[model samples]
Target: MKVTVELSSLNKDDDKIFGNIYFEENEYAFPEKGWNDFVIIILNWWAKSILKLLKNISIEEELDFMDGPASVKVQYLKNNSFSLYFILNKEVVYSSEVDVELFTKAFLKELNSLIRNIKENRWESEEIYSLMENYKMLQKCFIP
Candidate 1:
């Protein structure tokens, strides 16, 4: 399974970024806030558990939109070589790679934790709380 994360248009677009995380065919595209929003949500929701997964990951870039690189990327080269390419404003910025197994483990762990909290209505923020409420309401719909 390939896990590709793409980030684009961060600096110039009102300092906002957009991104998509794909697990082979499965995709969890973040909202307009991009990966930063996802990170913020994870940190705000459960930092103590997922922060350790960052140990093996490293992203080095200018992060300056005006006088520096326009994008950033991260990928996993070892093992399965799950790659993440970050393009800023349709321009290539940087690339980061990491192990898919480790990243997926952490991702699923956090996702499970998040869903558990949502189901339990233990969100500390209104954003997530509302999200969970909507999710609960969505549960009533029968999907074929």
Candidate 2:
């Protein structure tokens, strides 16, 4: 509802995004049976999935993603219609308030990208930062 990011990278499989996790955020929960089912599929398959796609979309849950020693927390903000944040360590590294409909669609698209990147062994590359910077332009459209 507030900000977003559109990313581009060399790989066809990547959305190249690095901020504001849409799927984890309650603020952008525009419910649809089809979409919910689709997310469940992705969660069931991704290498390091952060969601379980349970019924009712649990916003109070604190989800964390871990791969060996690395960890990232996906938080649920109760204020401002329940925004979601990605906290790295004790710092809030990424925060996004997305358009409910657009972000959901985008998140689905990006999930595939993430899977592809992970498969290609490039999920944590520098392109993520580039894409994050590129995505900052998204705020301009929504902030006004």
Candidate 3:
């Protein structure tokens, strides 16, 4: 499976993110208990870790998450009077904020850090991205 993230928004400071994960083989073929399940099961954990980083910066925020067939929203209120919203699911994932002044710098910094961590730890063990690569290659083989 291969997952790619795309960002779109009204401005460069606060934007929306969209993520799509493609599978090469049968959906049930994923090593993480087959393809019928989504990679989100693994990613959700990472999401929690990502939120922890903002613990000191944000407060009084509500994390409304729905582990259903729909989406999940994680909201964080920063000390600078800014709020960050992370809408994520198996098909789409994005982060944005309401306060420009508060989230502009912090949001970008946190996002960059999150991406870096994913890239670094992904190759260490049976990580989610590795499974995506396997799925992508497996699916590519069928293209011919």
Best by TM-score: 1
Stretches off by above 4 angstroms in model 1 are 1-78, 122-144
- Our model 3 lands, by Cα RMSD against the true structure, at 17.8
**Would you list the C-alpha lDDT of every candidate in the order shown?**
0.37, 0.35, 0.34
- Report the alpha-carbon TM-score of model 3 versus the true structure: 0.22
Q: What is the C-alpha lDDT profile of model 3 across 1-144, one tens digit per residue?
A: 122222121111112212322212234211122112233333434334324434443343333332334332334444433333333344434343444333323333333443454455342334444434433433333355
Alpha carbon lDDT at 129, candidate 1: 53
Q: Per-candidate RMSD vs. true structure?
A: 14.1, 13.6, 17.8
Best by lDDT: 1
Write the residue-wise lDDT of candidate 1 on 59-124 in tens digits: 221222222233324443446544555565666533445565565455444444455644454334
lDDT of 1 at 137: 36
- Scored against the true structure, residue 90 in model 3 reaches a CA lDDT of 49
lDDT of 3 at 17: 19
Predictions ranked by TM-score, top down?
1, 2, 3
Clashing pairs in 2: 1-97, 1-98, 1-99
Reference-based lDDT, residue 20, model 1: 38
Give one digit per residue, the lDDT tens place, for model 2 in 67-126.
112122333344323344545455655555544335434544464464455457555535
